[model samples]
Target: MVFSSESFLFLFLPVFMAVYYATPQRWRSYPILLGSYVFYAWWRIDFLGLLVLTTLFAYLMGQRVAAHRGSRQGRIYLTIGIGGCLLVLGVFKYLNFFVDSFAALWGTDAAGLGVHWRLILPIGISFYVFQAMSYLIDVHRGDARANARLIDFAAFIALFPQLIAGPILRYKDLEHQFEHRRHSAELFCDGMARFLVGLAKKVILADAIAPLVDLTFGASDPGFVVAWVGALAYMLQLYFDFSGYSDMAIGLGKMMGFRFGENFRFPYVSRSITEFWRRWHISLSSWLRDYLYVSLGGNRKGAARTYVNLLIVMLLGGLWHGANWTFVIWGLWHGGLLALERVTGWHQRAASYWLALPLTLMLVLLGWVMFRAEAVSDSLAIYAGMLGLNGFINDPLLFGAMSRESIALAGLAALVAAAEPKLWLIFSNAENKGPSGAVVSTRFPAASAPRAHASAALAHQNDGWTVTLATLVLGAYAVFRLTEQSFSPFLYFQF
Candidate 1:
């Protein structure tokens, strides 16, 4: 169930938290495992089996890797583990795309070839599978030790907060917390506030603006005016939607005395695509960099090889989002820009903040068009509309139907996005320091993007009551918005 849904908010959360706190400190994972399983099973019982099997397989493989560390056996086990997990992901996520592409080559579809069955991808397969793979990789790399206790390892993988969508928790980052988590009223409250703020962002901003974005993108030819408005509107919608989900997941982890690291870090403010990837989906970017990019020799090779590495990493990263050409192209777009910036030294120029900011934003918005579209043709049409290849108001009904409420909310969402850095600084005067403030250190330097540790920062900034009071006001309003609206699944959940 989605966090914003009434059933989850009113039923699952309240009941789960009570049971969680009632359990003993050392045995808390029992309740966590039970509740998390129930939560995952809420969607489908059959899917729960895959999750369980994946957890068991990863845990066992990790143990084997750990046992054979630094040997040929260790490398084989690691490859087996990674390959097995990717096999599951590929079958469920990309099998259909491959089948269709093959059929097209033969001038026939899957049905024509008598391949009638279609696979249903389990929700969060991409995320949990990656987590499992990362566990084995880390174990083999000696970055993290394999946990002998299956329960804790199970709990780590199936942790419901990030089970469906994630900040992509790493065993290395969160392992110590599992061994000994500090539970207190203050941390829980900070988490709750962060959850509320994310809820507000999703409901009041993202969801509110979604109808207009749909109307625009759904148009036959939205034209210049509608296209730009829709693109900008969608840009904000996606940011709030995905980032809001990350905040909630992180906050929920914090509530449970586990802190998921930052996933987003105010990417819109970035002056270059290099900086943008560093901030946008910080978890995934860092993961690709550490595991795939570095594995492919990173920048250690010559400049030409480095540029090729960038393209290949991003191309795969884009495909990781979906089995769509649009996503592949989106990855290439950013990858190309990153390579260009590296060659020209534009990323480090520091002389063009005024010019860079808008240029970067426009570039990002263009990439996002591809990201949001269903097909390459759809994205190309949208680009044509934005370029006025189709005149303004070609699809009059779509443009005319856009409500003022959505427009206003779109504007408000942009305002909120702009004010994010300031918002974190609002309640306090102190420069924050350390993990107690909720940001964690990672192996990569770029992993240390300035986090939107809003609730954590705010709670620490204030004299207690103010944080509570402010959160209450925001939470109540966000709840009102939630209950009044139809269910809107988080955008990232599809990934």
Candidate 2:
């Protein structure tokens, strides 16, 4: 179940949290593992076994790697562990794509080739497999110790908050928290506030604007205006939708006394594509950087090799998203741009925001066209319309499909997406100010005070009656929409 669903929000979460906190500290992992399994099984019971098997395989392999550290056996174990994870991912996620592509290349029908089996990809397979691989690699590399307890390791692997769609936590990042974490009224309140904000972003904003995007992209021959409008709508929809889920995941992590790293950071404001990757999907980008790019020798190689490495990493990174040619092309498109930036020094030009922002956004918007399209040809058609190769006319069908509410919400979403950084800064400054125009300090032990004060500051920022009223209104509206509208699955869930 997604976080935005009524059953999940109203039923599963409350019950899970109640059971979780009520369990004793020593046996808490039992409830967490069980709850996490139940959450995964809610999607498909059969895949639950696959998840367990993968987790156990990684755990065992990690132990072997740790036991044989600094030896050939350790490297062997590490290779086996990573290979096993990738094999599972490839079979489930990419098998069909590979088969079809091969058949097409060979001028033969895939069905006649006797490959009749069709794999149903488990939800979140990509995310959890990456985490499992990272865990094994970290253990082998001596960055983290292999967990002795199966339950703790399993809990870490299957943490429900991030199991489905993730900020992609590494084992090292969460190892200590799995063993010891504190839950309190302050953290819970802060988490609730964050969750509510994300809920509004998804339900009130993203879902509202999704229809216009659907109408335009689904058109037989959308005009230039329709195509651009749809593309822009989708740009806003994707940000709010995926980032909203990330926010919910993070907020849930906080409530459970675990800290997930930031995922998105006002990527729309990026002045360069390089800067955009740094801000967007921070976890995945860092993962590719460390595991893929670094493994390919990174920039330590010459400029020419660095460009090649960049291309290979991005191409594979795109393939990791899905078994689709559009994703591959999307990856290649970004890789080419990144390489051009490096070779031409456009990235270092220090262009002003007025010049840089639009250019960067336009590039990003064009990329999203490929990402959202069902096929490469559809993406090309959208691109053609975007470039005015189709027609400059505003399609009446497209204009008629958008409601006034959607248009207004789209405008609001764009404004919020652009202004969110400044809005947060203003709120932060206001939160730090005291009634007497001075900073308030709490007296506590040095180590404890900072954590306490930070939590307090978050609570303070969200504590105002105005914030409360706004949250309630937005939440109520979102709930109303949820009850009335059809299910709107998260976009990233397909990956």
Candidate 3:
């Protein structure tokens, strides 16, 4: 079930949490694991077999890797085992795409050369595949211990909070938690507030702009102004959709005493493509960095080889995102920029905030044409329209083009979210900083108190009555929006 669905929010979550907390301490894991399977099976009952098989295979492989530590044969066995998991993912996810592409290029139907069975890709196959692969590799590398308990290993892969979509938990990071986790009132409350904020973002801001994006970009005769606005709307929709989902996953993990890492970090604010990558989809970046890049010799190689390695890694990373050529092009676009930055020392070169930020955002926006379009030609058409090739004055009366209220509200929301006024900053920052606050205070004593004090002062800047009234208004707004919209599946789901 989708996290945003009424059935999930009003039914499944309540029942699950109630049983989860009420279960005996010794038996709590079973209830949580069972609840997770129920959630996964909501999408596809057949997929559960893949989940179990992969979990069992990874666990056995981990034991073998740990047992034969320091043996070449053991290392090779681990490689083959990990390769087996990837082969399953490749066959189910990409086999059809490969066949179709080959057939198109050769002017022959490649499907005729293969089995007739069309595999339905199990939801979250990409996520679990990477998670399992990471666990086995870490065991071989001596970074993590083999998980002997099959249930614990299965729970690691099937953990509901991050199961459907993920922040991509590393085995080493969560190994301790599987052995020991304590639920507390503070953590639950913190998690509730975080999940609520993300829910609000997705239901309120992103959902509100989605119709405009659909109307404009989905239009066949769209003009330049309409195209730009549509692109902007989609960019926002994508962020709040994916990042909002990540926030919910992380928040739910906290409530269960499983800490998944942050997956997004205000990537929209980055002034360079390289910086943007660092901030965007952080978990995937780290996963690729640690596993693939490091395995490929990382920066240990000379500059030229390092560039080649980066290219190879990114191309694979891009392919991992989807079975489409557009995603590959999107990955190559960023990879090419990164390579150029390294060679020309442009990474160190800084432009003014005004120039650099907008330019970088434009580059990203143009790239999204490739990402969001149905085909390469569609992407090119959108680019041409966005460049005013179809004329810029098409939408003379903006209010007439879209309803006056919609344009105003979308513009205001964009400004507020993008500028991130003090109140919004304080709310999101303080909410997420619960456990990390002590570390922050200890490391930056001089800045910590003032920051909190400034936030408090801003809270009181408006009269208490006015502030309370605004909160009520926004809360009402969120509730109204939630009631009107259905769940918007995160864009990352296609991966």
Candidate 4:
């Protein structure tokens, strides 16, 4: 169930929290594991077995790899573990894509080739499989120790907060937390406040503009204005939607005393494609950098090999998202841009911030067309309209489809997305000011007291009662919206 759903917010979360806190410290992992499995099974019971078996396989292989460290056998075990995880992901996620492509090329039906049977992709298979592989690899590389405790390992893999959509926690980062965690009222309150902010982002912002996106994208021949409007809407929708999920996931982890790393920064404000990748989906980008790019020799291999490595990493990274040609093209598009930037030194060159910001955003917006489209052809069609190759006339139906609320909310979403960091700084600075226009100080010496005090006060205000009250109000509004609106699945869940 989604975090913004009524059942999740009102029923599952309360009950889960109650049971979780009631369980003793020694056996706390049991409830988390059980609750996680229940959460996954809520989507599809049959796939729950797949998740368990995969977890067991990874856990067992991790032990074997750890036992054989520094020998040929260790490398062999590592290869096998990695292969097994990829095989599972391949069969479930990419099998159909490969089969369909082969059939089309051969001018024959997939059934005739005995590959017509479709597999149901388990939700979060991409995320979990990657996690499992990283765990096995880290163990083999002697970067982390394999957990002998099956329950704790399983709990780490199936942690419901991040199981479905993730900030993609590394095993080393969370291994200790799984074994030992502390809980307190302050921590729990902070998590609740963060969760509420995420809920509002989804229910109030993303969902509000979704109908306009659906209407425009679903149109058979939306013209220039309609296509561009829809593209921008989808762009905003995606950020709030996926980032909202990440926020909820991180917030939930915090409540349970696990600190998942940040997944997003202000990516929209990036001045270059290089900077954008650094800010966006930070976990996945770092994963590709370390596991894929570094493994292929990284930038150590001179400029030519480095560009090829970047291309390969991004191509495979895109494929990891889904088994679609559109995703492949999307990856290639970014890879090409990144390569060009590296070769031309555009990334390092000084440019006007105003010029760079819009240029980067336009490029990103164009790329999103590929990411969001159902097929490569549809994406091209959208691009054509965006470039005004199609008529510039506005579609009346598309114009009428967007309600005033949708338009206002879309504008607000854009503003928030663009200025959120600055706004937060402003609020933080305001909150840090003391009575009588003086700055409060506790830790700093008299000379540097004001600056240090501002920093300390910002942190204090973040966790204070003001945040709690704001969370309550936003959470109540989200709940009301959940009851009134139709079910809106998270965009990243399909991946």
Runs off by more than 4 Å, candidate 2: 351-353, 426-463
Q: Which model, 2 or 3, shows the larger TM-score?
A: 2
Clashes of each: 0, 0, 0, 0
Model 1 lDDT vs. the true structure?
0.86
CA displacement after TM-score superposition, residue 358 of candidate 3 (Å): 1.6
> RMSD to the native, candidate 2?
4.8
- Taken over the whole model, the C-alpha lDDT of each candidate is 0.86, 0.86, 0.77, 0.85
Poorest stretch of ten by lDDT in candidate 1: 427-436
Candidate 4: give the clashing pairs. none
Q: Per-residue alpha-carbon lDDT of model 2 for 1-495, expressed as tens digits? A: 888898898899999999989998778889889999999999889999999999999999999999999999899999999999999999999999999999988888678788887889899999999999999888877898885588998998899988988889898988888778888887776577668778888999999999989988898678888888889999999999999998888779878888788898899999899899999999999999988899899999899999999999899889989999999999998999899889988788736546988999999999999999989888888888888888986577566877889889999999999998876544334334332224555344567667797887566666565565666687778888888878898888888
Error of 2 at 399 (Å): 3.2
List, residue by residue over 1-495, the lDDT tens digit for candidate 3.
778777778888999999988987656678778998999998889889888888888888889888898899888879888889989899989988888788788777766666466668788888989999998889888898895467777878888888877878888988788778878987786676667766777777777777777766665546787788778878887787788888788778878777777787777778788888888888889899899989999888899988888888888888888788988898888788778778977666734446777878888888777888777777776677688886774655541556655566578667765765355445544443532233222133355688787776565444444534554565456667777877676666667
Cα lDDT of candidate 2 equals: 0.86
Identify the superior model by lDDT, candidate 1 or candidate 4. 1
Write out the backbone clash pairs for model 1.
none
> Scored by Cα lDDT, where does model 3 land?
0.77
Residues forming the 10-long window of minimal summed lDDT in candidate 3: 434-443
Better of 2 and 4 by lDDT: 2
* TM-score of candidate 1 on Cα atoms, chains taken together: 0.93
| Candidate 4 off by > 4 Å | 111-116, 350-353, 426-465
The better-scoring model by TM-score among 1 and 2 is: 1
